[model samples]
Target: MIRLLEEMEQERRRMNELGQALLEQSIPLSEHDELLALSQKVDQLMMQLHYAKVEQTERQYVRGGTNFEAPSMV
Candidate 1:
């Protein structure tokens, strides 16, 4: 999880740099394939991070046990 967070941050920084370069040159953002690809990669990493956190939480609950009980559906 820590490694994934670091990688995601690195990719986010690269994407920001690419965006700044495009803005400085007055180039259309849509024309940069690398920037778009980076954006998608960052998005994927974010989802992965979210899922990892959720999985970790579930594991903790399973290991320690939760106090709250499920409500009866009746």
Candidate 2:
């Protein structure tokens, strides 16, 4: 799990690099496809990290049940 987080962190760094390149106008139009692909990969990793953190927190919620409840329909 720690290894996974480390890898995700590295991927996030790469994503930032791509985004910065785009901002700096260093990336070519031909590379947009690859940049978009990397962006999606970064999104996926972020979601994974988010889910893991949530799961870890839920394990220590302290209460007997859930911490969130869906809004009730009228």
Task: Compare the candidates by lDDT and give the number of the best one.
Answer: 1
- Candidate 1: stretches off by over 4 Å: 65-74
Cα lDDT tens digits, model 1, 1-74, are 99999999999999999999999999999988999999999999999999999998898899986556788899
> What is the model-wide C-alpha lDDT for candidate 2?
0.76
| Candidate 2 structure quality by residue, lDDT tens digits, 1-74 | 57668878888788778778787886673468877787788788878888988887777675546556688899
Model 2, position 36: C-alpha lDDT score: 77
Clashing pairs in 1: none
Question: lDDT, candidate 1, residue 29?
Answer: 93
In candidate 2, what residue range of length 10 has the lowest lDDT sum? 60-69
Worst 10 contiguous positions by lDDT, candidate 1: 63-72
The residue ranges of model 2 lying beyond 4 angstroms of the native Cα positions read 22-31, 62-74
Q: After superposition, how far is residue 17 of candidate 2 from its true place, in Å?
A: 2.6
